[model samples]
Target: MTRNIAMKILLSFLILVAVSACASRQVALVPEDKPFSARKNAEIALLYWIDSLPHVLTTGVDNLIPSPARAAAFQSALEALLRDDPGLAATAAETAGYQVVIFNFGDIRFLALADSRHPGIGPTVIVNPNARRELIAGAPHPVFEEGVDIEAGLFVTRLEARAAIIAGAHACASSVASRCATADNVCPGNGSAPVRVSDAAHNTVLLYQLAHETLAHAWPDSIVFSLRGMMRADNAIVIFSDGSRRHAGVEALPNRLRDGVAATSLSSAGKIVSCQDADDDTLARRSFCGAGNVQGRFLNGSPDACSVDASASSGRFVHLEQGGIVLARLRSAAQLNLSGSAAENLLRGIAAVIPSSEMPMASPDSASGPGQDRR
Candidate 1:
């Protein structure tokens, strides 16, 4: 009787294992509709910060309206949340009901979201406290920091990058959907995805995302831009052979050129020498317009800028020794919008201008882009 019972138990165990194997095999073969695990993690990370941030910062411009106005502001945020992800909002409220509260700051220079569990806010405008303060103080948004740890930097960089990539993806998918809907054979699927406004805006956001990731990985603490300095020929300098470039901050450029020049690594090359364009101050800094660095000298450009000077060259492939707004600007602009020859040229220029000290001599592709998987 005991032997018969043992045999029956073994048979049942074998059947259970077979069923489990089949389920595992099926799951592995099927593609997920949504990467739920990844999306959930990202959502959690961002929400933690948003929820922790001073309510006024995220609540927007309705606080002035009496109690009625304040309620309206709260409704707006709730409405946006519901419109974007109704199901998620319901789940969040059911699970963790967070409250809205004001943050008392002696001086509200700027405000941003921070993680409630592992908040990474810096008192300084820039992300890195060690960095010079001006680097982040000058920017419209101070979310980007310099020389931050890969794990922390990747968190913010990814949040921004996703916005850009998703915008582009939505545009592409919607365009295809509209065309397909026109044909009766294949009516467009449900409008699960939203449409994006324009390619330019999407591209701009994407470019910023790439730049943010690149700088975070390349020069976590380097100072790239000055906050208030006027950009003069003296402010910009490049050394291709030694690979180092230094330029002025946002305050230097004319308002029109500020976004174009300050937001890129194109200003490191010597001034444009063409006589006709020289009169145009904008043209003078056009040499670095291409992606790669240029080697030469101007009366104002750096002469022997890479001669073992700690100030001129941070002695690191990317000068991240300092942090603050300089690091923020560098981190932000490192990813500029250029293509084919132009992109290569700009990258080459950056490689040449940044001093090579402790980092390996591998090129950008060989070295791996910033915010890469460390594991």
Candidate 2:
């Protein structure tokens, strides 16, 4: 009996030693946590802002600014992004109520700022501060940043960020690996104010920031129009399943026929065009579809059907009038490009030019109903 007891004690000792050694290895691999700073917070916020800008802008174009001028416009936008970097950081930090640390990952040349405010929230979880972090973290990579070359720069940045997060993740019990040290009960790092907590958060934030910057550079025209359209429309982008989206109240249409169905509700295709009912049955007669189909009449379901012609330009501007005054004028404007702010302005101008006598405010009943569209 004594021999059995002695053997058991020896086995327990060996197990303890093995566990200790494993923990030591883990701690040795991770970086020591340090103080967080304003720069880091700014970096995190910037990345998030950049990453999310594309979707936001895409959704609100037409009613916002209009079409953008590529050459001169893109440069101006890049400058603006750099200018706003600091403000973004301040906002993110204030929101978290904690300091942050940042690191430039060597591979992608991307930046990762650690938000260590709550070590309990998983180490280094990347954040799109303006949006939900949980959603951002798991989102597809391309959704955030653009022009990520496989060879260098931002690619390296992403790698280093991941490594750092992995290093510091032990701070939270949920992220703490079994191999973590007992002495610390967390990652082997000082929970310094503004210090980056781990890789996950850092990576996610950087991804978002890069995405924003990239989109800003790629689609300046879209940005201006989206904002401008929102201001004019006073409505939000309504998502649809056919991979096509709509920003109503910004663009004028005649009827609501979608996907061969009445535009009385959400649709997958072919609906009637609709608008704020004014007097111009022409503007109220047609609808734009995801497949580039435009059809319908600007009739108020009256015995007298009014035939009208409307045209959609590249930048998503649709011009329609009593006898095509807006469409004819816009079509003749050789300088007008529908893909930029100018196009948005043209759309706005078209809306403004039509005398109230011609345009009609749509009845609330004519509007698309909710959930009429299937994903």
Candidate 3:
């Protein structure tokens, strides 16, 4: 076990080195859906943070919702549980040169849903008792001295990624469903099953069902759009080489959950989540566009009812890390809000919780991309 842990640490170190080099490129950035400015890009690397254990679906994607038992399970899972199956698709994507890495912040932040109200969502910051009194003073949402975690971060923003994932899942389902048209057990591998969205699971589960269909493919490679800051679900910490590219997906969908406390298991290390655009068709483009095509959608599905104040709408994470919004922070911000005010006070508070600081930190002026500093 010791050796295994050591190897895991070593592997993480190597990845850190590679990702760091990529971040320093200072090359022209490309949109997530668009081709990389440079073609030799052998690998499409995706890095994200997750805070919880993803809910495990028992009766396939088709049945997770219609069955009241399943919904209860889903809601129950809203809090606890973690499994490692998404890696299967990640490996398959690697076949096509897609690299996906995840850092589990679950150790520092656990899975918790937003209050569904005006939740003060932002990067995890340490609030000095004094600072907390000043900024969060009259604010209903005070940065608690200790044991208070942001409930809605990347997890809630998943709605944006869901748009892309679902679109790809549909394409995958179409492909796999075609395989079983003539007979059962004809799909592929051990689980060549058909997906029926009409099965009546919750929308989220239904989306997963569509995504899981790609698993039946010899190689399920779909696109994953990480658009949570628009939803203000994450601290907006840029943990990937293409931080600017990833942030482009902002404001893609209606604030999926405009108001909530979102510090999720979404960015947790070792666990990767994304719905890749498995097929290159119109649906895929539209989905990606909807997620974040040039700061907003190309196709307007319906007027976004969530944003009461367009300026005040989501993007709360962007606000928390606003100053460095253009460039990736890679390091955690201590700013009180989007203004990117100094985080010194917040750090004093953070010392109480993360005194040792497993999370990375960067100075205000030096805006480097994501890396845990592998060297």
Top lDDT hit: 1
Q: Candidate 1 clash total?
A: 34
RMSD per candidate (Å) reads 21.7, 25.8, 21.7
After the best TM-score superposition of candidate 1, give how far the Cα of residue 314 lies from its true spot, in angstroms.
13
Native-referenced Cα lDDT, model 2:
0.22
By lDDT, the better pick of 2 and 3 is: 2
Residue 278 displacement in candidate 2 (angstroms): 22
TM-score of 3: 0.22
Q: Compared with the true structure, what per-residue lDDT tens digits does model 3 show for residues 1-375? A: 133432333233212111121231112232334332221121111112211212222223332222444333322222111122223323332232222233222122111121111111111111111111101100111121110111112112211111111111111122213211211121225363542322211122332332222111211111122222111213332121111112223222111211111123222211111112122122112222122221111011113311111112122111111112322221211211312322222223212321121211112122321111111
Top-TM-score candidate index: 3
Query: What digit string (tens of lDDT, one per residue) describes model 2 on residues 1-375?
Result: 133432332222211100110121111122233423423323332333223222221221121111233212322322222233423443343343322332222211222333333332222222221210001111111211121111011111221111111112221212212221112111234343221212221221222223322332232221101100111111111211111122333232312211112222222222223333232224232221211111111111111111112221222221111112112222211222223332233233322322122212112122332112111
Q: What is residue 160's positional error in candidate 1, in angstroms?
A: 19
lDDT of 2 at 44: 34
Sort by lDDT, best first: what order?
Answer: 1, 2, 3
TM-score of each: 0.20, 0.17, 0.22
Mind giving the per-residue lDDT tens digits that candidate 1 earns over 1-375? 133432332222211110110121111122223323433333232222332232112211211112333333323323223133323322332222212111111121111211121122111111221111111111112222221222122222321211100111112221322211111111124344321211111221222222233333333333232111112333342211111233433222222232233335444433212111223334434322211111111101233211122123222121111113223322322231124322234234333333223322112123432212111
Worst 10 residues of 2 by lDDT: 223-232
